[model samples]
Target: MTTDTELKKEIAYNIRAALPKATSYEDYRKLVLALAESGDTTGDKTVSYINYTLLNNRRMKRWDKTLKITDEQMKGIKAFSGKVIWLVLTESWCGDAAHTIPAMNKIAELNPGIDLKILQRDEHPKLMDHFLTNGARSIPKLIMLDANSLEVKGEWGPRPAVAGKMVAHYKKEHGKLTAEFREELQNWYNKDKGQETFNELITLLALENVGNSANL
Candidate 1:
């Protein structure tokens, strides 16, 4: 039987192997846009997934255009001096990834110490397994690592705190997330304007503070 520590070591090994093949956020965005334009998707290229890819392309564009970070948040982002890589697992058709990844890119943009990388979830099943949320392969999972050491520092994912809570409560009540609830979640993401995601990411960075004393 694999102990937790051994499992983590194995996962880290897998992460190292996957990193070289990971795409930059810019490249991932380009791929997504091309797929949307060509009526295709990254994984399990079903018609519905293709449609979702198309829809998510527009969502990402909107987020890229409209997502705003407050000055304080920017300060928090800039205070971090430790070099790190944010390896994100995602698929083009994931609605949450569409909304949150752009915000992540914006955060990475503000800090030279941070490098953001993307991996297609289906393409890296073994890597995805280690970061599974609730025994399921929930995506847009950000795995933060020490760039030099490749040590896992922390993670943030699938949804923001509030959104995760909402999902949990809804799932508890209904046993599954419905299409209507998904629509509601998208509306929530739109109204929130990526603020929730930004705030949580700022918190994650603070928690991983190496020697930085800056308060968020």
Candidate 2:
């Protein structure tokens, strides 16, 4: 098996090569709209053919609203002093990416220490492969890296843990994600209001800080 150091070097080199293909959150939104306009679709599921386009469009609007950051979340974000690069792997057609990216963008915007960059997952297969969730290439993976050292501090992705569990439960019980199931997932997101996502990411960052200190 490859060591973490070797893996980071490889991922860093690949990111450098693929960085040019990355876009800003706003650009990603534009791309999603462009594809929707052109009737392009994504994902492996057959239903994705019809739903990806509509969901992407809907997510764009969902992300446009101001995400409320709790006082505790704000404190945690502000306390981090390290300069880090938040490299996010995603695609415009990914419904999950559409829903998750905006809140992440808002969080990054809150801290000057964090610089967020959006990279298309398909365009950077090597890096995306390194962070696959359950051997699958999940979208909207936020990889935190030391700004100067370029070492990966930590990662969080695809969806909040609570949502991930919900997905797992649904998959186990229903066997597959249907159109109705997808709607149910969206309803969960609506009720959660991105709180779980924010809390999870903040926890990851805090752990990264602890790891950094341990190494020192």
Clashing pairs in 2: none
TM per model?
0.95, 0.86
- Model 1 alpha-carbon drift over 4 Å, by segment: 210-216
Taking the tens digit of each residue's C-alpha lDDT, what string does model 2 give over 1-216?
989788768888986776667677677777777777776754442555546766777776766675789999999888776688888997666767767787788788888887888887766788889899999988879888788877777889889888899889998998988889888888888787788888887787788777767877
Clashes per candidate, residues 3 or more apart or on different chains: 0, 0
Best-performing candidate as measured by lDDT: 1
Tens-place lDDT digits, model 1, residues 1-216: 999999988998999899999999899989999999999999998998999999999999888888889999989998887788999999999999999999999999999999999999998999999888999999899999989889888999999989899999999999999999999999999899999999999888888884345533
Candidate 1 Cα lDDT to native: 0.92
lDDT score for residue 143 of model 1: 97
Task: Report the poorest 10 consecutive residues by lDDT, candidate 2.
Answer: 41-50
Task: Record all residue pairs in model 1 with backbone atoms less than 3 Å apart, i.e. clashing.
Answer: none
Off by over 4 Å in 2: 1-6, 41-51, 211-216
